[model samples]
Target: MHRARADCTANTSDPVDGQAMHRARADCTANTSDPVDGQAMHRARADCTANTSDPVDGQAMHRARADCTANTSDPVDGQAMHRARADCTANTSDPVDGQAMHRACADCTANTSDPVDGQAMHRARADCTANTSDPVDGHAMHRARADCTANTSDPVDGQAMHRACADCTANTSDPRIVQQCKEIVLLVLLTPVILWVVKPCTGLVLVVLLTPVILWVVKPCTGPVLIVLLTPGIPG
Candidate 1:
């Protein structure tokens, strides 16, 4: 009875419990213990019965915790936190990859649905125009136009061929030889564009172009073309 009265004294002022207060009073009154406010004892007893689920019994924190899941921060975007981190949420993949690639925005490649290696192939997509799929694809095939901007001419004369041609005109002492070298260079360059798939044949042609063969250059103009044919015939 004393213990019940003590609990009643301690918890009668509890603000969260009006119904429990009444129950506590009834339990104390029914006890028939002397020198104690039996009603208060009973009421406090019922109120303080410690229903683990009840807010009045200090279970408010437990309920609140149960209601709240862990706040998981998204890995792709470090700051955004989600309650449950749904699987459908953007995993670690960059959202930019899925959108239309912008020419001005570099690194927007690796679009969604692309395989893993697709990113490597599309790395230059940022420098490409809207209609162009890749930066290199902007070249019109391989036949180079004079301007060479975006290699507008099909059969693209890409920068590699241009640079190769430029390398050919080096270290010429004779005027006649220079003209002959130009002719030979054009023939050598033309063959590669037609059979571009044969890298080795094209590479051999490039070597001849770059060699600055003084003897062949002196072969009046026809000699250079013949030498190109003999040096690296078009691969089958």
Candidate 2:
């Protein structure tokens, strides 16, 4: 009876040890599964973070490309603007060749006739007519007549003289004829004084002194007068 009791107690102890071993195996499987699942979740999170950062990096690269394009285009636009301004300036200035500008100036000056030379011719003509009967100084009379004819010759010349005379007569209280007469009077007054100062002691001295005086007085009066009188009216 004692041996059978001991055998029964041994069988009960073997069953308890089996249950404890089964429980330990179940706990170990649960622990291993938790660690594996946590590792898988961490890997998924890291992949998601990397994917999100890629888009941001792509956007940054795109912005950098746009900036580079804009920077390169700015200099090209500036160069175009500079070229446009240079073309405008070149068009406005005196031509780079210079000849065109000179020609234009010469054309302008040639078209507008001088007034002072015309007036002098008229005065010489009047002097010639008025002094015609006095001693018949052939050279003096011829010169004066030539000057008068030149100044009064063209219709346009006559008209211009009349207009100038009328304007001068009207604008100021002084008359054109009177001013001219005064100039003649002054010349006459100075003539005697010049002769007295030069005081020719011999015929040769007188001839020398008189020749230049005659030429000086006559040439100024005659050349312009001849030009005025001889030139026909320009065709329209």
Residues 1-236, candidate 1, lDDT per residue (tens digit)?
23344334333332332323332333432321212111222223322321121211212111122233223334554532222112222213345454321110223333233232233112222332111112233221211222334323222111222112212232232234456677666765575555455676666666557445633554445565566656655455
* Per-residue lDDT over 58-168 for candidate 2, one digit per residue giving the tens place of the 0 to 100 score: 111111111111101112122111111111111111222221111111111111111322211212222222211112222111122323332222211122222222122
lDDT of 1 at 180: 63
Q: Once superposed on the true structure, which residue ranges of model 1 sit more than 4 Å away at CA?
A: 1-107, 111-119, 122-125, 128-186, 189-228, 231-236
Tally clashing residue pairs in candidate 2.
1
Lowest summed lDDT window (length 10), candidate 1? 54-63
Query: Would you estimate the TM-scores of all the predictions?
Result: 0.15, 0.15
What local lDDT does model 1 show for residue 21?
35
**Could you give me the TM-score of model 2 versus the true structure?**
0.15
How many residue-pair clashes does candidate 1 contain? 20
